[model samples]
Target: MLIRDLPYADPGVPDVRSGRHFLLWLGRRQLRGQAKSLAWGTLHMASVASIPIAVGLAVQAVVDRSGGGLALAGALLALLGLGATVGDTMLHRTAVTNWITAAARVQQLLARRTAELGATLTQRVAAGEVVAVSTGDIEKIGWCVESVSRFSAALVVALSVCVGLVVYEPELGLLVAAGLLLLIAVVLPLLPRATRRADLQREKAGRATELAADTVAGLRVLRGIGGEELFLRRYRSASQEVRQAAVRTARMWALIEAVQVALPGLLLIAVVWHGTGLAMDGRITVGELTTVYGAVTFLLFPLRLVQEFAMAYSFSRPSAARAARVLGLRRSGDGAGVGDGAGGGEARSLENPAEGDLHDPAGGLLAPAGRLTAVVCGDPDEAGRLAARLGGHDPSAEEDPAEEEGERPDARERALPSVLLGGVPLDAVPLEKARAAVLVQDKDPVLLSGTLRELLDVPGSGRVSANEALAAAQCADVLDALAQGTPGLNGDPLEARITERGRSLSGGQRQRLALARSLVTDPPVLVLDEPTSAVDSHTEARIAGALRRVRAGRTTVVLASSPLLLDCADQVVLLQDGRVTAAGTHRGLLRDDPHYRAVVTRETDDELAEGTTHA
Candidate 1:
């Protein structure tokens, strides 16, 4: 694979059984590039090996005073030089190609996994680990991939040189071979130490990265709570830990480098010293002695390649393991189930079948179709979990019973309760089909950085226009805010650029924009969790009314306790300890259910008065 073919091509299914298996799979995928790299690398090293032999022959010829032989030797040397230049250039090109293509393939796999898991990925994996895998991990994996062919070529050249030297002079050749073996034996044990240090460093770095990402994501909240210094100190400590680990890892590597350099130098000196003794005794000629010295010196290059290959592999193993962890994550039941009668099979429409109600068997809460229903749960976390289940995402349903034996039997039994739509189990349907039928907007919706038009250009039929969605979201003030901030927008809010996560905009503005984006998708079932939490009471009231009108005939489930939003729902269900305690109109619930009233009326009379004054 080439770099240009990337991002669009399928990255193929990976064998993610283990990190080693994944690395091997990557190598198999890029056989063609690997082959080219190997061929060029062999040629390059062969040219290098020929140089010493040519020089040895030239010295012999000059000593014998043979002009013709000298001329032949010079010609051979020139040819070797030319071949080395060409081979070196092509080798570099192919090696780089291998590196780039391998990295691209890994990146594509990561991107696909991220898309498949969507918002749930962060729930399963750390944001920093993902970032590290996509960045540093990939580079290390590519380095190992690119080093393989070169290492193979170097090994072959080194072996051939050893054989040739033995044929020319046995004693010197044997000594050199023994020295090479000694070097390998000494370095082999140190590799495990280096690898351990690398793993430690990577672990520290991943933690630091996770902390930084969390700190940045919650920077606004930290500032509001006057906790920036606390987090800053925590991050600083994490950074220091990373630095210390890196230093320890580097020290180990430096020791290995010292061994690589010192051992090779000692070997060279031993070969030369032995060769000099042989020459003095007239057992070997000066020309032959020169040949042995030059061969051993040249052998250092290939020995270094061996060292590099080992280092690259050590660094890449942990990275590949991280990558494998991500790639191994499959959606709860992706491609494993049949679809529901509605929007499944040959049917492509996203419309609900028979205007079905959404039923949560575990919570015993039912959201009737074609109406605005509100659910208020005492525990926000439980509410979010229930909301996810309503949207066909039950984490318990995806767990393995055999692995989770420690869980209570009753809890395990209750865990797999499937949310049904139109009387059909949601999990029985294919994931894409189920997702198309229901849209869940979380409490904190992310607004991607883009123009308003781009942000609202979500997948689905264009049933709702951007303007209509924006109006339904009560985004006139949001557009006005954008127009005021951005020059050349000229009051064209759709053309204005939003900063990353809408940080440049106010909290209410971001919330409204997110709501507009969700509205544009026009799904049959819209599940909103605290959609108006950031807005003022008056704006929340306006949004509640507008949302009802916009989703008049569709099934809309709002998981919130806000009085304004609940008052707008056609039916309000109060949930206490994950079970429905009361179901009625908002006014009826307030009058009859004291628990419901206390939960909904937590916003004090003073806050209500302030809201009224602001309005």
Candidate 2:
């Protein structure tokens, strides 16, 4: 396959039956490339092997003072050099092609899975592990894939050379074959220890990566409490552990490498010593002895390739297992999903998501179709939780046995608990379809760094234009924020380049921009949690009015306690202790429900104290 054909049209659902299976599947996926690599590798090694034979022919020809034989040897040597050049060049080209293509396929599959899983992927897979997999693990997997052909070619050529030697000069050939076997016997036992050390080093390194990622993500919080030093100490400790583990692994591999080098050297020495005796005894000529020595040296390269294959496999096995874990996350409307992540066959589409009300059986909350519903909870966290459920997700599923352990026996047979959309289980529906049907905007939505136009470029019903959505979300000031001395923006706020995570914008601007992005999507159902928490009361009032007018006939669930927003809702529900205690018009709830009033008012300290004194 050409580099242009990378990221397969259908990276073909991997056989994640096991890590071993996944790697095998990668091999099978690029069978034609593998075969080409094998062919070229064999040719390359074969050409190199013939060089020693030609050298021996030349020596013998010169010893016999035969000009014709010498000329033939020179011609053959030139031909062998040409073959070697072509073979080696082609081998490297094919191997690199295989590496890049395989890596691209893997990266695409990962991106697809990430998009499929959405926010839940990070909850299940540690940030550090995800980073490691994306950055480092893919390369290891590519190495594993490319090594198979190289190793096979090396083995075949090594065996052929041994056979040729045995026939050419039986005594010397027998000695060479025995030495090769002895070398194998020596390296075989060292692999297990070396592999163990490598695994240990990998595990420590992963832990260090996780610690560093956590520290960076929470750097603000850590600094607020003067805990930066604490985390720094922790990171240093983890890093030192990684260093120690690496050193141990290095020593073990060093032992193996030394054995590889020393044993081969000993074998070369023994071959030369034995061949010299044969030459003296007239069993083999001086030129034949030279040929034997050269052949022994050629075997060294193939032998090293064998070790390379082993090292590649050992390093990639863990990475494959981690990748398998990520690919296995299934969609569940129950907060966190647990199943074979890939929807079996084609995932069913949502026929009519807006045709029915969204009901949360546990909390007795219902957001009706073609209307705006406001849910107020005393606890902000409770509102966030309700929002996740409304959109058909369960964060609690992070506790799933399959996710925790990376694999589970008999996980595929279990049925998924789902959120109902139009009286249909959302888990049974495809992720892309379900997401398009119901959009969930979290309380703290993140803004991706990009041009303002790029941010609003989302799949939507197209009923709401970007300018309209931005206006409705009260993002006029946000537009100014985007255009603030930004370089390469073409003097258009829409072309402004926001910093990563939109850090260049104020908290309120970022919130409004995120809200505008959500509004632009214009899904059939929208679950927005505290969409205006960062803005002032005036902006919040305006957004609440605009939201109601813009989404007049679309289902919108706003989980917020702001009185202005609640007053604008067609239906306001008061939730208490994780249950819907009351539901009615905002004014009616305020008049009749003391708990609702208390939550909505968000009493000042003095007012609460006066009320307590009166009580």
Best by lDDT: 1
Q: How do the predictions measure up, each by TM-score? A: 0.88, 0.86
User: Over the stretch 1-615, how does candidate 1's per-residue lDDT look in tens digits?
Assistant: 666776636779987766788999999988998899888988889998889878888898888898998899899999999988998999899899899989988998998888766666675678888998999999999999999999999999999999988887899989998998998898899989999888888878878888988889999889999999999999999999999988998898899889989998999999888888998999987778887888988898998898899889988988888788777665444434354344363233224442888888877899998899999987888877777777766655433323221221322343556787887676556777777888888777888887888998899657788999899888998888777767898656799888899998888788889899888888888999889888889888888999999888889999998989999999999988878889999999888666787678875567656755654
TM-score of 2: 0.86
Q: Report the CA-based lDDT of candidate 1 relative to the real structure.
A: 0.83
Residue-by-residue lDDT tens digits, candidate 2, 124-233: 67879888878788999999998999898999999999999999988889998998899889999988887777777777887888889888877766877999998999
RMSD of each: 5.6, 4.8
